[model samples]
Target: MSAGPEIRTIFWDVGGVLLTNGWDIDQRGRVLTALGVDLAAYEAVHDEVNFFWERGLISARDFFERTVLETNPQLALTFEQLWKLVCDESKMLHPECFEMIAHLRRAGSYRLATLNNESKELNRHRIDSFHLRRFFDYFICSGYIHEMKPLPEIYRAAIDISGFAAETAIFIDDKAENCDAARSFGMIPIHFQSPAQLRVSLAQLGIAI
Candidate 1:
């Protein structure tokens, strides 16, 4: 039997794979507590608005007005203040993962891109603050593209943009569902655990850094 096509393009997920999640449930709880806000009220509206926000269907102002400020009127914080809390929590980026990316880039052996589900304001902040553009040749984010992962269309769009066969592209994400989606779309999927595990997985696939 023939071996699979050589992996030429690598797609990375931002939240868990690249850095800490922008505003995961734990982070939200922490931020809310720090601000002395009511958690129940925020959670009541979070489920309704978070996905839409991540998909860029709503602006940051609208998200705050509808989900946070309106839902809990007693909270005495501006949108920017709350946003800063989220940003603070997201700074736990893994340096080893970035080092690996740099090594791969220096080798000039693969095309690198980020495919992530992120809200518009948060995504913009993270990318700009970290200078992630320097590392990636392209970005496939839900905020700009209006599509989140575990969906076949987003995978199709990324594959289309890279101009590579899906079979020759590898996608790395922390979520199993997202990895499964990539596999279903004929892309090699790596379920990321840690930076060390990732190095091992890539080495196994003949993608040694």
Candidate 2:
């Protein structure tokens, strides 16, 4: 069997793939535990407000006010405090993955871009704080586009924006569903497990980093 065409563009997912999941269950648990907040009460409405929150429809203050503070008024934590905790935890990025990106850029073999799901504030903070702009040609953020992953339109939008044919590009994400969506759009998909695993996968596609 022969390998596929040379991958011209590389699409990466931020959360879980490049960085830790923003405001995910583990981070939420740690933050809430430190704040002495009730996990059950917060989770009861997290699913309802999280989508809107991630889409930039609501501010961090508003999200916490409606979901956590309003539901559990006995909690003494303020919005700023809660926001700080979440932001701090969400900004953790894998250094090896970044090194890999830098190596890919040095090789000049592929155009790198990010297809990530994040809120406006969180996204802005993360990119700026991490200096992630140096690593990618473009960023396809769900908050900016009002679209999330595992959806077809976002993948289509990425392909259009990147100016690369779907067959000549590869999308790397930690989620199987997101990878499947990329495949459905005719882009190659890589289910990222670790930097080493990703290196092997990319090597198989003639993309060494």
The TM-score leader among the candidates is 1
In order, how many clashes per candidate?
A: 0, 0
| Candidate 2 lDDT by residue in tens digits, 126-193 | 88878889998888888877878887778888999988789999899998999999999999999998
Which lDDT values do the candidates have, in the order given? 0.86, 0.85
Instruction: Give model 1's TM-score versus the native structure.
Output: 0.94
lDDT of 2 at 28: 90
What is the alpha-carbon RMSD of candidate 2 to the true structure? 1.7
Residue-level lDDT of model 1, residues 1-209, one tens digit each, is: 12789888999998888788988888888987877778887887797898789889998878877877766668767788776767888774688999999998888899999999888888888888888888899989887778788877788899999999999998999999999999999999999999999999898889876
C-alpha lDDT of residue 171 in model 2: 91
Error of 1 at 209 (Å): 1.7
Off by over 4 Å in 2: 1-3, 91-93
Q: RMSD, each candidate, Å?
A: 1.7, 1.7
**Steric clash pairs (candidate 1):** none
